[model samples]
Target chain A: MPYVNVKVAGNLTEDQKRKIVEGITELLQDVAGKPPESTYVVIDEVNRENWGKGGKLLSDKEK
Target chain B: MPYVNVKVAGNLTEDQKRKIVEGITELLQDVAGKPPESTYVVIDEVNRENWGKGGKLLSDKEK
Candidate 1:
């Protein structure tokens, strides 16, 4: 089974989530030969406060 | 940079989160020779309804 985890720095709408799940699964099937039925796609929506880049939290970027 | 993702099937308290983050960061530093400051440890507390195994949703298991 191919377990794929996708992390993003905010919330996603239900429609967005569905598309992402489909896209990632299709990409894996096309590139890695993984079967969609056995693939596990776990999406993580991290809070901006919990993620950081360049020594600054994503939560602070909006300021 | 070594990016680590830790997924669990429920919510975690702040204390639990602190411990887990520290543990994973230290593990990578010790085993992979990665620096703790540079390693990224992302924790995903996945809801049961969003996860499945053996053709069954984890949310159904408790019922």
Candidate 2:
């Protein structure tokens, strides 16, 4: 079983989550010959305040 | 920057999550020499219905 975990710096819509799950399953099936039925996709939506990049929290970044 | 994403088949307590984050950070620091400040840990709690193991959905497993 292939378990795919995706982390992002904010919440995502249900549709977005659905697409991600589907896309990852397809990709694994195509590239790694993994079966879609056994592929698991989990999305973790991290708060901006908790996510850091370049030594800075995502929340502190200016838009 | 090292990003860690943990996926589990069910919900976890706040304490458990905290410990996981800390443990992962420490492991990365000790083993990979990654700095704690630049390391990010995200935990994903997946529904049993969505997770499969041994060609069977986790939800379908009998207790």
Candidate 3:
């Protein structure tokens, strides 16, 4: 089983996560031919300041 | 750049995806600590019928 984990900025409803997870599971099944039970997906959120790109945090870069 | 893609069952808002992306970026930065620009994440959605587990589609198993 393949466990797909997504890490991102915090703040989302369970419904939103569910939809995203379900969508991904389906895609993997078709492309990778992995069964739903054979695959697991998890999302992880974090602080914007902790994320940096090109020496600047994501939140700062977006500003 | 390392592009993280998540394939799941369809249906999620842009905002929700954004949040998920941001959260994941932060985690990689902390754990793997990769620069935000050095990494990219994408979410792909699909139909439940396409996802199967234990010889049953996700939708069918859920029912």
Model 3 chain B weakest lDDT span, ten residues long: B24-33
B-chain TM-score, candidate 1:
0.88
Q: What ranking of all candidate models by lDDT puts the best one first? A: 2, 1, 3
For candidate 1, write residues B1-63 as lDDT tens digits: 888878887799999989988998898889889998898878878976555443334555577
Query: What TM-score does structure 3 among the candidates reach?
Result: 0.49
lDDT at A44 for candidate 1?
Answer: 74
List, residue by residue over A1-63, the lDDT tens digit for candidate 3: 445766656444676667656765665555555688766877666777776657887788777
Off by over 4 Å in 3: A1-63
lDDT of 2 by residue, A2-60 (tens): 98878788999999999999999999999999999999888878866554444444555
What's each prediction's TM-score? 0.55, 0.55, 0.49
Ranking by DockQ: 2, 1, 3
User: In candidate 1, which residue pairs clash?
Assistant: none
Docking class of 1: incorrect
lDDT over C-alpha atoms for residue A44 of model 2: 74
